[model samples]
Target chain A: MEEQVLIAGFGGQGVLSLGKILCFAGMKKDYNVSWLPSYGPEVRGGTANCQVIVSDQEIASPMFEASTAMLIFNEPSLHKFEEWARPGSAILLNASLIASPLTRQDVRAYYVPASELAEQAGSLQCLNIVMLGAYVAACHTVDEETVQAVLTETFGAKGEAVLQMNLRALDLGKTYIQTQK
Target chain B: MAKILMKGAEAIAEAAIEAGCQAYFGYPITPQNEVPEYFAKRMPKLGRTFLQAESELASINMVYGAASAGVRVMTSSSSPGIALMQEGISYLAASRLPCVIANFMRGGPGLGGIQPSQADYFQATRGGGNGDYYLVVYAPATLQEMCDLTKEAFDVAEQYRLPVMILADGTLGQMMEPVELGNYVPRTKADMTWAATGFQGGKPRSIINSLYIQPEELEERCLAMFDTYREIQAHEIRVEEFHVEGAQLIVGAYGTMARIVKSVIMQLDQAGGPKVGLVRPITLWPFPQEAFAKAAAQESVQAVLSVEMSMGQMVEDIRLAVNGRKPVSFFGRTGGMIPTAKEVREQILALCNGGKE
Candidate 1:
């Protein structure tokens, strides 16, 4: 299977890190993965994005014009990438920040209240983790156990409170999508 | 060891360390800053030298100094920064110093944007520096190839006592992939009888200088270097070929552009379009002329296309290599604009249909 995923948000919103986590988890599952970030002149409030490809076959090019799936966190991202979404693609957006409805009828859209869920789980920093959970649930791109393993290994050094908060955020996102379906 | 995810720049730095790079000196530039940043954190911990030079000039000169002392040294920069170091690079070449230089190129004739580009092809393949010299240049397309070639670059430099270059772009530098780094066995330095270490009682003092007072002496040095260059050209040309045995069109590209062209070839194949092939040059300086010549000699091959991120720099080499065996065409995007797969596919189809794109 081949999954070309694009993640876009503000520079400080962990857009790049979210892509990195997915690639790392994909690697653990023996999938060929690549991550290419938009390293433009982006500041804290500026736009940021990354392209990720996880496939069973070797990836030829990391940059793609169309995405099989997209995780958009802001209105700017939604406006920018809506056209690049391929038909039958999945778009997971942040409902807390993007109030505009998706205009494309060819793709599937999942609206996750990532910011609200992060705050409810105790920190706004884990909003990316919430989106990750929703993406995993909606697309089945990776397994939940592999993601949890990655999170535990990545955040285990930060202390139990931070680790627990992100874990709770992941569950909240997953449950939200599952209940909606 | 198992594979781990690493950015291309960081992976190159680690590969250098694994290949026993003893010193690093470089100034920061966009699209390649991670190279120096990686060295800054890891070099000191490993009891090696990592200095952020005041400028690109100082960085290359420092490299010359360390290489003269028989230490494996490296430095990295982007397009404009590399231009600033041309003089020092020439000096290093003339002195026969073994060192590695990496150019994670960006758009430029001057200080251009910090995006991926192959505009520096002439600057890299032809001597960007002054004097009659050549650097063994490798253009790697993937992160895994980047690491493998980086490790091999140091060995090639030391083997020939000539400078070597890793010519990659910002996209390859910034991208991440799973790569299996080789075991970290520090390389043992070979016996360098000409290194400028402390003089022995009976031996002559080793002098490292590029200048020669007499014209005859300079000519002799140039002739000797050319002999080494001829040996390298004979034995070191590398290329990758795909479905070139009996194809109508053969696409030629290197580095990032190669990856894109390969994808387009696959897409065309899946769609049952014209039969296409690719010849990706791994060694840019050696040019892989033989590979192109042989591929073009096939009776089924009609035309050749050179794809690049610049406005047809490498196409000149392709034409010279083909030597009228097939009509060579060019397709490119410039100023940090990467060509998409659709664009490349269209170009290929146009070429196959006997039309200019």
Candidate 2:
């Protein structure tokens, strides 16, 4: 199986870290993975994006024009990448920030209130993690336990309180998607 | 060692350390800053030298100094910064210093955008420095290859006592992938007898200088270096071939562009389009001339295409390699613009249908 995901948002919105964690999880599952970030001036408070490829076979190119899935966190990101989504692909957008609806009709779109979900879960910082949980639930690219393990490894140093907060955010997202279905 | 996720720049630095890099002297440059950053953090902990030189000029000269002492040394920069070090690079080559220089190239004939680009093709392979000299240039397409070739670059540089370059771009430098950073086997400096270690009583002092006052002596020195270059060309030509047999079109690219072309080939093959092959030059210099000549000679191959991130730099080399055996065409995106797979596929399809442009 192969999945190419493009994640885009504002600079401080954890867009790059979200992609990194996704790739790390892919690596843990014995899959080949690559992450390419958009660097330079554009990443400083401007829109930031990263392309990630996770495949069962060796990946040829880290950058591609189209993606099988996209996680857009802002309106600009939605506008920038909506056309690049492949037919029958999945798009998970942050409903809290991106009020405009998706333009493409060939793909599946998931409107997750990531910021609101994170706010409800205790902090707005876990919005990206909330989107990750939504992506896992909707696309099933990876398992929840694997993501949890990654979160533990990533946030474990910050102590149990922060870890629990992130865990709750993940569950909130996943449960939101589950209840929707 | 198990594979771990690493950025291309960071992985290269780690690989250099594993290959026994004793000193790192470099100035910060975009698309390649992480290289020195990684070295700065890790070098001191390992009791190695990591100096952030004032400029690219100082960095390369520092590299020359450390290398003359028979230590594994390296420096990295982007296109503009590399341009500033051309004089020192030439001197290092003339003095026969073994050092590794990595160019994570970005767009430029000048201070261009900080994006992935292979525009430094000519500057690297043809020598940006004055005089006739060659650097063993490796253009790696993947992070794994980046690490492996980085480790090998040091050995190759030491073996020939010439500078070696790892020609990469910002995409590869910034990208992250799983890599196995092989074991750290300390490189032996025993063979570096020519190093300027210090004078000993009754022993000839080793001198490291690029100057030869007499024209005849300079000519002799250059000819001797050419002999080493010829030896390197004979032994160290690396190329990878994919679906070359009975293919109608063959695309030639290197580094990041090569990977993108590979993806295009795979897509076309899956869709039952015209049979396309790839001839990727792992070593940019010692430019796999024979491989292209052989690929162009195939009866099924009608034309050759050179894909790059530059306007058309590597195309000249491809044409020289093909030598009228096939109609060679060029397609590229310059100034930090990366060509997509769709665009490459369209180029190949146009070639297949229109037959030679």
Candidate 3:
């Protein structure tokens, strides 16, 4: 299956990192993957975005005009990308920062207080990880087990305690979706 | 070796190292600064020479110096920076110094923008500097191809004693992809007779200079260089064809635009659109004129579309290659704007429907 995802937020919000991790996770599973960022002139606190494609076959174009999934972390990201969503696509909305509700009826929308949930579970810096967990739980783009393994491998060098906290943040996000279900 | 995920810039840097390029000199430019950043940290560890020159001119000249000393040396830049290096590039070409030069092209006639563009097609394939010179230009469609071609570039330059250029755009330089870096057979440059490595009681002496004031002597030198160019054209033309068997419409694209055009072709194929195909020129300089001629002369081909990221630069070569065998058209997006696959497919569909776009 080919999965094209767009993740967008403020520059310091770890949006690019979220996309990078997903790319690494997809690659670890031997899938063809590409991560393309919207760079140049973007600064801290400015809008940051990236497109990640994971496919079983060769990925022809990494730049996606429309995406199968989107993670909207702020209002500007939602306003910018909501109309570009393909039909039946999933949009994971971070309710903590975005006050307005998603009005798109064609695509599925999952609302999670990502920053609040991450703060409660560990730290607000893990906000992206929380949303990533919720998105993975909602749609099985990549296996949650594989994501966990990737996270462990990625964060292992920091320290055991830091890794556990981030893992807990991801689990909290997954549990948040399960409770809603 | 297992495949590792790497950005195109880093991959190019590592690939050069793998190819035994012992010297790198460059000045930083946006969308490709990572190349120098990578080499600065890695080259020291590898016991190679890495210098961040004060200017692009200085950087290219430094490469000239190292390459004249018979070491595999390279330099990279974006469009404006590359413009500054044109004098040095011409000198290297005239002096028959083998070196690799990479241009991660951004939008330009002059610092147009820091995004991707193929506007430099004319500058790359044609000589950016004055006089008649040709750099064997390789346009990679994917990051893996970029790495592979970069490794092969060193050998091609050495074998031909000519400058080889990896003419990539900002998109390919910035994107990340999984790359399988296989082992490269190391090339030793110890016994190069033409190299200016000091007359160590060997032969007599070697001189590397591009200035021959005598008109007749300069004409002879240029004719000799043209001989090398002719040999390269005869032997080293590379193109990748897709679905060209009975295609009515043939799309000729290169670099990032080729990848996007391929996507459009795939969609058209799936939706039972016209019999379309693509002819991707992997080597832009040795323009693959013969392949274009064959495809355009096919009984089924009615039109040839040349898509680029410029206001139609490479289309001229396409027209020449087609030689009026079929109608050649141009499609492009300039000033750092990338055309979508859907838009290209729509254009193709319009053409299929006999509507001019």
Provide candidate 2's TM-score on chain A: 0.97
Candidate-wise lDDT, in order = 0.93, 0.92, 0.91
lDDT of 3 by residue, B57-157 (tens): 99999989998889999999999999999999999999999899999989887778999999988988999998889999999999999998999899989
Docking class of 1: high
Candidate 1 lDDT by residue in tens digits, B178-218: 88898644335556878887767767788999999899999
Q: Which ten residues in a row have the lowest lDDT in candidate 1 chain B?
A: B182-191
Which candidate model has the greater DockQ, 1 or 2? 2
TM-score of each: 0.98, 0.98, 0.98
Taking all chains together, the TM-score of candidate 3 against the true structure is 0.98
Q: Could you tell me which residue pairs clash in candidate 2?
A: none
Interface RMSD of candidate 1, in Å, is 0.8
Query: RMSD in Å for candidate 2, one decimal?
Result: 1.4
DockQ of each: 0.87, 0.91, 0.81
Give the residue spans of candidate 3 off by over 4 A: B185-191
**What lDDT tens digits, residue by residue, belong to model 1 across residues A34-73?**
9999997989999999999999987888888799999999
Show the lowest summed lDDT stretch of 10 residues, model 2 chain B.
B182-191
Candidate 3: tens digits of C-alpha lDDT, residues A1-181: 8899999999999999999999989988889999999989999999999999999988998888788999999999999999889899999999999999887899988999999999987789999999999988998989899999999998999999889988988998889998999
